[model samples]
Target: MSQQTGSLISCTFVCLLLAFFAGQSLPVEGANILGVFTSHSPSHLIIHMSAMKALAEAGHNVTVVCTSVPKVTHKSIKQIVIPLTEEEEKQLNAGMTGMAKEKPSIINTFKNLLGSLSMYIDKQVDVLEDKRFTDLYKNKDNKFDAVVFGFFFNYYQVGLGSLFNCPLILSWTSAPMSIVDESVGNPELIALVPSMNVAVKPGQAMNFKQRLANYFGTTLFRFIGFYLETKNVVFYDRLWGKIPDMISYDEAKKNVSLALCNSHAISEGPVRPNVPAVIEIGGIQIKEKPDPLPQDMQEFLDNAKNGAILLSLGSNLKSENVKPESVEKIFETLSKLKQRVIWKWDDLKHTPGKSANILYKSWLPQDDILAHPNIKLFITHAGKGGVAESLYHAKPMLALPVFADQPNNADKLVQSGYGIRVDLLTLEADEFKASIKELLQNPIYTKNVQAFSKLYRDRPMSARESVVYWVNYVLRHHGAAHMQSPLVHMNFIAASNLDVYAFLAFVLFIASLISFVVLRFCYRKCCGGKGKPQKSSQKSKVKKH
Candidate 1:
């Protein structure tokens, strides 16, 4: 009995020793994350949520502070929803409605920013002051490894990352722009890379005029962004300035660990330059296998004998906002198409006069619907997220661009021969119908887009995978400060080497002045000395003669 007891004790000791070693070898616990996505646009929210959902799936604890409730969320993620007030909702809708009527140009778009930006800023400040978001910091025990923010011209929100003393990960919904680039110390690249609001053809060279327009458009918009940021400085100081050991807003701005942009340079062109810190997860929102469509939608799509067309103006569209006449024209045009149509109208009770072939849904699974085999053309507002999905699904698009990047996105789409673009505000029945028929009849658009889709999906890792890895990487490396470009910390004078150039110029100027003075003094001294002797000697010679 004693020997048996001794053997059991020895075995237990061995097992305990092995367990300790195994525990040491196992991976550490997942990091805690905070997501701040306060963009007024719902499409921007979709991209931000997709990225946060990825982090949660990778075993991290993610807490999101967003203005609107997300349609799709992960079990592991918790949300602190702060919806806009009824007044704010009206203002946002009104702003979008007013914007849709304007002729879509980079100038006109930015020309309208000042009036609408304040509303967006007011919305952000309101979200910051909310008790639910404040409680995260009020309770001292709350800790986060990183704070991911959706970049909607809100630089002040970087203070939250500062308040948490964690990495600030910025999320941009389009390709690199001066606005996004300036945050992470990326070069302006204005010569080659057009602003997100200005679209250039994928592979086409920019003419002098195009380049000139890009330069001015980029500068003016950047100034517009800077102006808006300056206005938000007060809000930033009010909320985050008082915390002890708090990093300054300016410091936090330069310290952004990285940015994840929803753009693929390979598929979407003007191949500029990028720093290591900028990660392009262009089609991050696209699912590898799209979710199953609604039974009715599935049936509708399955029954599409002639290919189908999808029309979505994105989250901002409202029946009341769309001019009735324009609606009549659009309806008259779409109602006559041979292809079946699925219109994502906001109001189901009173849609744009539905036809037998048209299916109206208040809400749509856009990505899933695009992935359907029968979807031949996507008529969209050309928002980055929608364009990315359509491109991923290899569906050609007809863009009725209204404002922001839509006009630019439309121009780029047309250049790629993917589809045509028409002004939504001035769309005529004949033109709209002709554009649709052209895309449907042309095999070139379909062929070009399909080939591009192959390249888009050929990434070494998927966008979701990229998000998980990079977020963890930032956590592991303590903000990945080394990957940051030196430009982030540099002022314009220092970054442009203007200071060095000025110093060199001063030195050269001083040297040149000294040389000129010395030469002048020596010449005068030698001439004066020699002249006096010659005059005196000639006078003496004249007296002797």
Candidate 2:
């Protein structure tokens, strides 16, 4: 053979060998991911889909076990849909529709109660003993390297994690890390980013009363959550069989190897007690190709000379339900404004008669709309998803928070100097107009938002990449046991030193007694001689007489 031909064959042989080794070095061919997401909320679905996409791209087998089918289309992932019963579905639909009259008040609450009971029963009876659920564990045919569970209201995911006996990671789509990062003791008080002092300087902090209110708000939610979950476990046991001792906060916290929060450092400040295992992989949606706006809306934005304001209440709130009076006020305010308005009013029939500059649509491409050069302000409900997107786009906001964590989110936004919080319940046309004008005219809000936007976008790695890295890290480290917190079993009082009340009381009592004795001694030393000597001499004189 010629020398050149022999060399070519050798090079090809080397290439094939390298490719085979590279394939072997990869973690595994398939990663079976079990994702539990909020059944009702699209936001959770969106986040789960994003993470699933990233995992799929990384060549991991992904199986999502969520309450409902998500919006995203992915061929690589398998979805396990758990359907709600007719009664449960009714309650869920009622909650979503805001139609309390259609069902008894106890229905929704009872559903949660029942769910907790059911889970408890399942655990006690070992009802999940069968291969249907535990099949993932026993099959030994297909071992899962890691399990990812959503941190929604349901605790069943944690139970499922226990069943699998694998490394578990929590994917929190909310702003506060308290649910997963319990080290800080108090989730609400611990600001995610302690460094950014935009509106309220750190020193000029919220007073005790305000802090108490925040604490109560979070604590109340947690208490109700626990009660509902426990009830579900009990109910499940009665219906099926006794479930094992599978559901526990301590177990979940201890077993969870890593936390993946859908938050960025720029938008969500530094989480307390920063640990290597807790990863903030926010702005996942921004990583995707944003849905585009209609051409007419684009043309309108292009033609607007004074810039535009984008108004949206997210997906849950039906624009139709907004009181007509509030709508009138909004229209009255918007019509007079010099700036053009692009409002996402799903049902526009109820909107006030149109103005030359005002536009209404069933939906708007929020990210694209925010990114538009002509868009100046975002009127949002302060959903975390919307707030994160707004931060990414660098658009200041007029936040009209309705419910849930939105009010708190708005407070953060206003405090951060990038938004204004307008009370939705008692909105006034004139006040609304004035606030909108102020936000538009104020250059600082724009400047601050733009600054944060830069920080949000200039991360070391994209949110998707960060999530993928940690998911793999958990698998590679055999569930990353080193990352778990040691104080998993401690309660609030024990963890906070409130459990030392007895010692405190003893010290206080001793201090009080010592103070009383000192005071008596001092009284005698200062005033006794002046009155006593004369009394002794007078008594002696009287007796001699």
**lDDT by residue for model 2 (1-545), tens:** 99999999999999999998996567644666665453455666777678878888888888766545676637888776554457754554444344211221223434433442233123322323323445555576755667776665444445555656677777777644445555222233432222111123223554555555545545655666667567545543443334464545445545667777777644456424456667788877664455666899989999999999999988656665466777889988888888889988876676667898899888676777887888999999888888889888889999887655566678788888888888776789878988888888999999988988887888788988888887887887778667655445577777666859978999999999999999999999998769988999999999999
- Give the top-scoring candidate (lDDT): 1
- Which has the greatest TM-score? 1
Where's the lowest-lDDT run of ten residues in candidate 2?
A: 190-199
| Stretches > 4 Å off in candidate 2 | 1-29, 67-69, 72-75, 80-144, 183-222, 225-229, 232-253, 265-267, 288-296, 336-338, 348-359, 489-545
Q: How far out, in Å, is residue 62 in model 1? A: 1.3
| C-alpha lDDT of all candidate models, in order | 0.86, 0.67
Clashes of each: 0, 30
What tens digits encode model 1's per-residue C-alpha lDDT throughout 514-541? 9999999998897767898899999999
Q: Given candidate 2, what's the lDDT at residue 266? A: 46
TM-score of 2: 0.72
